[model samples]
Structures are given as C-alpha cells and as structure tokens.
Target: MSVRTATESDLEAWVALRLLLWPDTSPDTHRAEAAAVLAAPEATAFLEKAEDGSMRAFAEAALRHDHVNGCETSPVAFLEGIFVRAEDRGRGHGARLLAAVRDWARGRGCAELASDAHLSNVGSRAFHAALGFDETEHVVFFRMPL
Candidate 1:
C-alpha cells in the first residue's frame, strides 16, 4: 500500500495495468507507446505498489503546452490516464497516485490540471468530480476515410 514514481524497470507491470485500463488497445501499440513515454523526461508516471510488491494502480501525466480543451497558450498538466484494479479500489491508492501527479504538475509551473474521461464511465466521472473537476463541455468527434 505505497505510491511511488514509476521507473523504467517497472515498464512491464505498468504497461500490463494500462492494457487492463484500455482493453481495446493492441499489445504491440501499447508496448511502443509505453516505451516512448517511459523514455521521455517531460512525462511522469506513478504507480501504487501493493503489500505483496505488485503494482495495483497507476497514473500518468505529461506537460502539454498546446491549446487544450479550454485553455489558451499557457502550459497545462494533462493527465494521460489513471486506473485502479477492481480488487484494489477504495483503499486510498488512487488518491495517492493523483496527489503525486498534482505535486509534479505544480512543480512544473502549471496553473491547472486537466483531464477527461469517457462520458459513459460513471465511476471516472464521479472520481474526477470528487477531485474538484468541473464539466466544461461535451465534445463530439468524427472521422472520415481519406
């Protein structure tokens, strides 16, 4: 029941948790993307290790200077993803991981923390709201074959 900064050696377990978080993603793409993030200095990942020495939850944050949902030119701390295993919920691990990201973002000069969850994921929506996030708008997107 401890939270700590993620290390390169933790990549496999971290990626495994990510696969569980986004089950629709293929393993190959996950591997490549995880590797890239783990190698980036601007990105930070945090993991909650269980008493048994296994990763039970994790979160990732990155510095985003580009225009985001409602912001202008100022850089923002963008939460890439966050997940906690069903068996590990309600144990304060999620809060710890989030706190780490908040501190990291604050240290980087970010005035705000921004993140989004699928509209249908009630739990995520609730969690974000509990963390003081307000709904800005509903975003819909479309894609066309080129």
Candidate 2:
C-alpha cells in the first residue's frame, strides 16, 4: 500500500471514499471541498492506495486555529474525516492513513491532533480509543430558527 497526499489525479477516487463518510453530500459538493482542501495550506487529504491503483482508505484534515475540545494549542490538527472500506478494516490501513495525517500536521508545527465522532456512533468512538485517543468531552447541540 502506498500512502500519499492526494493530487488532482486522485480527486475522483478520493471523493468517492469521502462520500462514504458523508453520504448525503453531492459529488459536486465534495468536488468543491476537495478543491479547497488541495488549495489550502492548512488542509490536505491523504490517500492509501493498493497496488492496483485503487484507494483503500483516505483521511482529510485541516489546521484549526480556533479552540477545539481537548486541544491546548492554536492551529490544532483537526481530523475532518476518515473512511476505510469495511472490507479493508483491521488491516492497519486506517492507522497508516492517520499516521500520514499526523506527519502532515507535525510538519506544520502543530502540537496535537483532534477529532470527533457522532455521539451515538459507538464503533467510531471505539475506533478512536483503539487509536490511542482519549475521551475528552461531549455535548449535544441545540438549534433554534431565528
């Protein structure tokens, strides 16, 4: 498996995997987001690809300068999304992808990496814990139409 920062050549495949994480979003929307990620100095997408040129997993991340839960530094390396095909799970592809994201963040002088999973997603929570992330804080959001 080869892990590398995504390029325009990998855009379509990367977006396909990303949609698995955000199934409701249109391909156009993901395309725009992908463009921004590739353009931004603070954001990047890392892809793990099989020898056949198929991507097995990918991770998107951005440098969040704002205060993120459990981070004590500015420009926290925030994990925006990650997805591995279910068939590809438990083979260390996710960990390798995450390590790529971590190296990207560390290269930019970040002190910590931060991420969040939906409150009800036990599998996601467990995945994070297995990756050595500690439970930090949780909150339920409230919204009111103005």
Best by TM-score: 2
TM-score of each: 0.93, 0.97
The per-model lDDT (C-alpha) reads 0.87, 0.91
Clashing pairs in 2: none
lDDT of 1 by residue, 82-138 (tens): 999999887777788899999999999988888888899899999888877787777
- Writing each residue's lDDT as its tens digit, candidate 2 over 48-102 gives 9888888889899999988898878998999999899888999998889899999
Q: What are the per-model C-alpha RMSD values against the true structure?
A: 1.4, 0.9
Model 1 stretches with alpha carbons more than 4 Å out: none
